[model samples]
Target: MTSDTLAPAKPAVDLEGITKRFPGVVANHDIRITVAAGTVHAIVGENGAGKSTLMKILYGMQKPDEGTIKVNGEEVSFRTPSDAIDVGIGMVHQHFMLADNFTVLENIVLGAEPKKGANLDTGAARARITELGESHGLRVDPDRLVEELGVGDRQRVEILKVLYRGARILILDEPTAVLVPQEVDELFDNLRELKADGLTVIFISHKLDEVLNIADEITVIRRGTTVTSVPRSAVTDARQLAEMMVGSELPTPETRESTVTDRVMLDVKGLTLSGGDGGRPLLSDVTFPVHAGEVVGIAGVEGNGQSELIEAIMGMRALNGGAIHLGEEDITSWATLKRREAGIGYIPEDRHRQGLLLQASLWENRVLGHQTRPPASKGIWINRKASRADTERIVKEYDVRTPSVETLALALSGGNQQKLIVGREMSGEPVFLIAAHPTRGVDVGAQAAIWDHLRNARAAGLAVLLISADLDELIGLSDTLYVILRGRLVARLDPSDVTPDRLGGYMTGAITEET
Candidate 1:
């Protein structure tokens, strides 16, 4: 054998002394990462720890202020995403980007459609998509509309979209953030297939367990720098990895003592809503009550009317039938603003859509829902000083990692944004809080802090309706739990008695109330 055959091959991706800086923050500094060819390389970090920034530099979304990037042992500079793509790199963002009205094939071949004369050669594109799907175990029908596909299938389409562009290396940013347990398993399977086919995957995630389970090598980044990079064998457990990422022990959501009270604070009776195509009701006869100093968690698969139930309670959606009462007063007829003023706090699931104005500063966002109230406003005149001061307080209290209160909401990391929202809602002295996926994309540290806040609020006699896809969070934080399936409250589970596996079965409709 030759000397070259005996030596190991170079990494698919190598970054040396990479540094990135913003106005008042050093996003990354002297970061080094190496991904062995055809292996799953996981990047684990807390929110605002520069994981995404490094990935952006790698994918050409942002250029590093210093250092070098090497692809397959060859130095390269990527000025744009297209430049990275040209060097066989592709990135799947945390959010799925697809035209809702377009077909799968159309979406896949959108910017790079094959041309035959003046017309688009969709047939050739479809054939290639089919071949890619079969070869990579990413099976999907090209004729299906993007809107009609499920989340897992949509993710597959995204992977196929990049594969169609001839990418040898893939960067997945929080790919399983929105997927359920089963869907996540399937996604891992798909990833394994990609790895088997000699494609390198750079995975970035806050979920340490998933990272440990799927990754060949794990890189821990903290405070805008790489802490350590180790093979899977070097790390013993997710707890160790989390501690490395956060530089401390992991926090748990488990409540010590039951703070649930007998006084019912929020009451919903016979809640019903019309479904799509006028078939089944979206929320059917959903009746539940959250007592003062209690967290009533709703556990269900995503899209099984969790959003509708929260919206109905918030008065954002009109109910066909049902009575909602806060304390003793009927609030079913109230508008969204009225509900807000009535001490019903809302932390929306999609933060960007219902929570904050990206263009506005953090202080401005703090005054959003509480605009007409005292502190944020005085008789319709904005209290800018009060808002700014209060925002600074929230930033300090909630541990929102930001340079200043004047920073734009868009500048903060997802977890920090979530923390700010949590602080804002809790600051309003709400009688009943509808916290929907409050810690969805937050890091473990932030999640623990948010849980601590919720626990503290519960101790102080706050009623909460917690909706989350994380089974552990629901089981740990909730005093009482209800399982919703196909828009109905299918099972009332005791949080102490249920396991995540059992909960998963109920969420997927595999296990019924009778069982």
Candidate 2:
């Protein structure tokens, strides 16, 4: 026999004819994928392209209507998450599933605690955890509370949780979504370590650059089916993979010509938020100006006063001391509704929490923020017919894919929900916009579309205060950029002069502002 015949014939994972369906939607259709052992395999797709559905099926969170799954060359069926885990497969979710009050050890050993004579074997578990940490390069103090950990450390804990359960095949979903550039590098390093230790990883991400950098094999999913799978050597870069995923060249956020005007639309001076109980101030003398037809982007690690600044600007939170001006009008003491009525549009960070009513119909949600304006309301009554008509316009113009306007917002994908919110916020032609993580959890196409909308609005003299964790987005879309450190605006720079790597230095306080 030849060497090929003597070699192993089966892959680490094999899925054939995988199919799943929901009401009026075929989430996955005849999907097929093969992953090699001891390598990083990446899955890339658009927001609504059925990637999550497929992952759910594989993890046993959802049952496939039709398919054959093979792990380690043995055909298997998983009816629950435990079944998958028993087969050596473990999944780390996109949204973390951990109690803040729990210690790291408790969170990891909650379901699978070692027992010794009717007592939980805490000593044995700690020893095992310590060993695993050293072996996998995923070290964390076992006694640290989950709440006290940073984003990167929390992620390490999640990885350890899965590894603690004896998982050899790991699935990580959007693993670096909330991480800064430095954290992303560390994550990649950890992934490399996993690969070195004879482990298989299936990484799902929307970040093409990171995927290209780390993935050994790539699979593209579109709509509800597999488009293609290529080895890393076959593909050149992120742009190529993006075109394969969305069937076009990835859109750029670069603005060739400046649209900034001297007309100042948003001005803040001496913005401060006191820390109760006489601690440090949450916002310290924050000051900035967004002129008409300009996009002023803020770059920071999450929780560094970006959210507070946005809320303060929208009048959703009280400031300790400051003045907010909109077109020369001081709106310091205005209520949230008054700010909206005065032409302030807000795209909140959490769409499900602040942007849409999940149980309500799409048409109903279209009137959410614009309830007092025309096309959504007439006099004291909601114009349901007009609102539905306008919803149709938004769905078409914004490329929101859905069956009908009567569908509940909960049934729509996250990207579609975000598109609806963007449409609603852009309706009244607000003079100033606060877009916080506007493109979070969205695919490349949706991101490009939103960036286009912002650019078009900027051209029409709309000022935008853009806050995003995406350094490239901030650098490409902003005329000016601010770096926030511990609730203070520490550095200001022209967007043209900064790179993402350089901006990451400012964000992490590794590089100080040069006076």
Candidate 3:
């Protein structure tokens, strides 16, 4: 089946004059979009740009305050996701909704489980899931528990789940955010195959390059309004798309003089951590030094002991073997708080899981890393006014879009949340900063701003250990890049000497030869 065959004869989904409002916010105003059948329609915008809100309305996750939705020219309304699914629409959220302990087949057919003789029909569901995977070239292990699967495989399971439910229009939100380069390539291939098989895909992404590469038409959203929709051929380049997204020409970071000080701010020597099986260490003899005024980037596929390495460094997990030193002091045995107090600023990879309390107000989240900072506290009494003032400063400086510092962190857009987190981490002025995927899910404007901030921090003589799945980001920002494969530092490259393709080859363990 070709995409041509799969797409409806006309527009598969259409929205006109959509409007949604929240307390003190107009989430979406006079939005209009038309997604044709069998074409990859991309929605690009900064965080809190109302793209997600519009998608939610389409998927029936939320009812629009005013608008009309049409499926194949027929007006429709969806009060719940089930209603959308019933009309052949399925949405894959940024966060996977699979139960870790459940088998892939179980997760796929969860709410609509087949029944045989008053019991759940596991056999039929497994057979159906296998058929769907084979038909779509998805290649998933239906019996494998989600917890045992890699992130890429887990994403595949999510896609298969939607396909199994007979969805004709597939919506993917930031599908490549967590994927490595190879995985991203594979996903694009799979998406192309799906399109060829006649499925309409509405792809939401912050990465303009990917959108231009895959989309037939592109829709750019700014703030809470629809800026314009244009053919893929019209935009010409990422710069044009970026201009539309931010309504401004962004400045490129200039190559700076090597201001790296000879003194080592952070040193890791022969660091090793036992794997889950407790045999060979997951991190084997990893050693590196972070010097002041330099950004050292670790580029690796996910689960190559990067998480373990960060955990060990932060003192959240014990090290099986190795030593970590901050300046001249050994901190391998110190508590996480003590390490932080000793001048370590850590922005964890999983922001929702480890970084912020979603339900807490912005001020509370802002003061998290610096509860002991002067003015935030005195002896045992917490100073609310001082914390609010500090948060307001960050909000104003970082351009965080919030009505007040008392707004729940969860209510902010992904980009704004990231800005707040970055601001909080940088505010401490730590000697060493550990930033993992700091720009993930953020728009181009915010990404440029973040790069500028990191450069300024480096200029101020802060040593940075940056970890990211974004190969371009790793190459663009890092002075030196290290690639890890299966818990080993496989190759190190000067950023100027290596391309993203070469870096990806090293990251995927396809290239073992040292550069």
TM-score preference between candidates 1 and 2, better one: 1
Cα displacement (angstroms), candidate 2, residue 268, comes to 2.0
* Clashing residue pairs in candidate 3 (N, C-alpha, C atoms within 3 angstroms): 2-196, 3-196, 6-198
Largest lDDT belongs to which candidate? 1
Please, what are the lDDT tens digits per residue for candidate 3 over residues 1-515? 98877954768888998999988788899999999888899999988899888898999988999989998788999989999999899899888899998988889998888899999988998889888888777888888888778778889999998888889999999998878777888889888889898899999998888899999999998888899999899988888888898976644544457768898999999998878666556898899999999899998877688898899899988887899999999998999989888899988898889889999999999878677865567677678998899999999988899999999998888888999999999998799999999998888888888888999899889999999988788887888789887788888899888887788788877877663
Q: Which stretches of candidate 3 lie over 4 Å from their true place?
A: 1-8, 250-255, 277-280
TM-score to native of every candidate shown: 0.95, 0.94, 0.94
Stretches of candidate 2 above 4 Å error? 1-9, 115-121, 275-279
Against the reference, the lDDT scores of all candidates come to: 0.91, 0.90, 0.87
**How does candidate 2 score on lDDT?**
0.90
- Which pairs of residues clash in candidate 2, taking residues 3 or more apart in a chain or in different chains? none
Each prediction's Cα RMSD?
A: 1.9, 2.2, 3.0
RMSD of 3: 3.0
Q: Give the better candidate number (1 or 3) by lDDT.
A: 1
Pick the TM-score winner.
1
Counting only residues 3 or more apart in sequence or on different chains, how many pairs clash (N, Cα, C under 3 Å) in candidate 3?
3
